[model samples]
Target: MKIGKSKNLRVGEWVVAIGSPFQLRFSVTSGIVSAKGRSIPNGSDSTYVPFIQTDVAINPGNSGGPLFNLEGEVIGINSQIYTRSGGYMGVSFAIPIDYAMDVADQLKENGYVARGWLGVSIQEVTSELAEALGMEVPKGALISQIIADSPAENSGLKEEDVILFFDGEEIFYSADLPLTVGAIRPDSKVNAMVLRDGLKKTITVTVGELPKDPALAFNETQQNFLGLVVEDQINDGRRLYIEGVMVTSIDPEGLAYESGIRRGDIVYSLGRAKISNVNEFKEILSSLDQEKSTTIGISRNGNKRILSLNLSK
Candidate 1:
């Protein structure tokens, strides 16, 4: 069967799904491509699968069935559905034929898929975060953490770097990075464009092979004397471009809470020190003078503001 070019499929384009949903044989459904490059949350991290979303009626038995264009060319494979109930909810996802074919070829050759890996964790960029980072628009994946001894670390990809392009393809969302990186052959060098400190730069990286078990370990609580409870924004399971300490709770009568800092405030910078994570927040707080007023940069609900706190009072 001829395979359609999924890359050419655009939103609102007509498509068809042929499958055996709920044990019914040769069922056919028609729909339009609803969206692309969607990132869905998976456990602690998210999977960067550029799914072709459709209103196609795909159900439990429809997985692995071909999704075709009007020309009878296969464009995708019905893979998942978005539903609160155990039935179709007008939203279904298909693995793009390009990606699926790549995996199929690799598995047929080596009995397993060898996906290229870049050792980094990333999150999506929000409009508020873009302004805070001096970016004119919210695009690309924001590197939240770099794994030690990984290709990203070896290539000098640092935390807070916004990866704009990978191998000449623009990454419109954070999820696009993994989809692009995973399709490459391991040990191949590729060019990447990244925005660092509001400046655009290009770097080369030698992609590594995916580890059998890739896991990120984080702690539950941190100890700080600032009378505020903060967590690492990036690792807290929320996809956001701004990296800093997110205030989860505040002591009602404590210095921070009394200084107009409340729950849900993201502390981006304190005085002249930039805060990227909880550790950095604690470090900066350790050096602060208890008798002086301090200036803090915070983003509250997409609005940036400056807060001055008199710790001496």
Candidate 2:
């Protein structure tokens, strides 16, 4: 039996796991409740997901196996193990039945899981960022970029804005933002409180349907780091419009990547010069003589950021 999803799980439940350890087949292990709602890093990109902690003596090949209650009702799936000698260390972890069910459902329905999107890119507020910018303690998610015409952008979210709460939920860490916001239903208007320039501002945004495909938005290869493909920002009418080169895609290895520059960042100005279009962007790049690192200021998510990047000759 494969148990997925933790919504129905309870503490103090007896559970069993069956799998192979070190190629041992049909191994069985049992344990009582250890803990629940523990978080683990999802992948290399630094996202986190909550998991169930169990002491079921699990090991390799045990992953994806079911954890059963004494009643034989599956409660979790053995997923990971903590080991010092390439073997079970008596401590193992499982994806809760509910969470697993959610993952499986999403994968089956959408070909991928659609996480709730706040439509903003954020960074952990640092003390220097706090002091340099007069923040409280570097504990909130600072908006580094906001998607244009996105739910966040439409709701007036600005760059450099520090998010303190979402739907009355305190956002102390970056990881919490996604989980809390994703739990909210799409197409619902919700309140978000943020500290903009040290002042708290509340805005309401209707959560948009999250895209089923992650690659569609991230497919560009030469766009700026601020999340926009520009053409020009300088028509008498366009100056009011704020245009620039049409972004093609992000340079995956460019300075934009390390600086948290997303796929749609728009190039408005390099340093202080206004780049009207792609030709202007070329001019700016051509003007550079392979000297040292240059400070690039980009416009993203209705805000601006300065990044120092070393240019390769």
Candidate 3:
């Protein structure tokens, strides 16, 4: 897969899709570059996977296929299709080769993607809400919730703060925050310009790793970290009754990566919690505030291991 430069995406230019559509191997579809930097939903998290919207007939088995330019250079990867009857609805989406390649590289290397942490929950601004807040409408993400102990919280970013610029990049919407933040290196300090109470202010923030589990009990809303979910697994007789918090997934660029924990890793204890499942471990983590760190003991692939993580407050 070729990683195209972000600047190379030309509008109205010819592009091709290479994939196995309808479970057919080696299928190729042709179309033009529809748009870039488009936003799509990813459950609770908003996916900034810029849609290479095309008229191509992308179907099943077409995933991972390349969308090539007229020059045969891969511009995007055919990924998903919007359909009501489980068929292409003429609005097929391809992951921009650049973005797809980036994600693939991160996933392959680190087990998950790493994003910058701004520590704020944002929503699209509305005229009524803007009027209520006494601001302009239809622009920028509204500060709906701010995570405590986050860079924004430490830097004085308050609720209703409208982020206008991150570093030097313009933040036209909330989705831009994750993209901008994710691009920053961990522990590096960056400036964020926000609109608060009609007054513009800049705050410096130290970037942190995106967490592997958003539902992690360490904090109610802290997901900017290395992704690795593990629990204690109890073994029984021939059935080998499995009970314990077992690692389901490990994100790339996380501390767990350095620790060599992979999928199916079973965690037994975190400082004597004796975790047997996700909920059991979650119960222990629930008591931990932002200032606490948890030392973990895990069993992976039948081997025992120990790791420590200072939970980000």
Question: Which lDDT tens digits does candidate 3 get at residues 23-138?
Answer: 77887677776765555432223343557677788887887677777766777767777665768777777766666566677788879777666666565555555677667554
Candidate 2 per-residue lDDT, tens place, 1-313, comes to: 5443465566666688877767888898898767665544322221324567777777778898888877677778788875547677777788767666776887888786665566776655656677877775766677777777877788788888888888876787654676566655567788889888678889887776555554433321123333233333223222344454423234334454555545335656665677766778877866765665666666554466676656542
Query: Against the unseen true structure, what C-alpha lDDT does each candidate score?
Result: 0.78, 0.63, 0.63
The runs of at least 3 residues in candidate 1 whose Cα sits more than 4 Å from the true structure, single-residue gaps closed, are 44-48, 215-313
Each prediction's RMSD over C-alphas, in Å, is 11.0, 12.8, 13.0
Q: After superposition, how far is residue 287 of candidate 3 from its true place, in Å?
A: 28
Estimate, for each residue in 114-136, the C-alpha lDDT of model 1 and write its tens digit: 87888776767877678899998
How would you order the candidates by lDDT, starting with the best?
Answer: 1, 3, 2
Better of 1 and 3 by lDDT: 1
Say which candidate scores most in TM-score: 1
Q: In model 2, how large is the Cα lDDT of residue 15?
A: 80
- TM-score sort, best first: 1, 3, 2
> Can you give the lDDT of residue 284 in candidate 1?
87
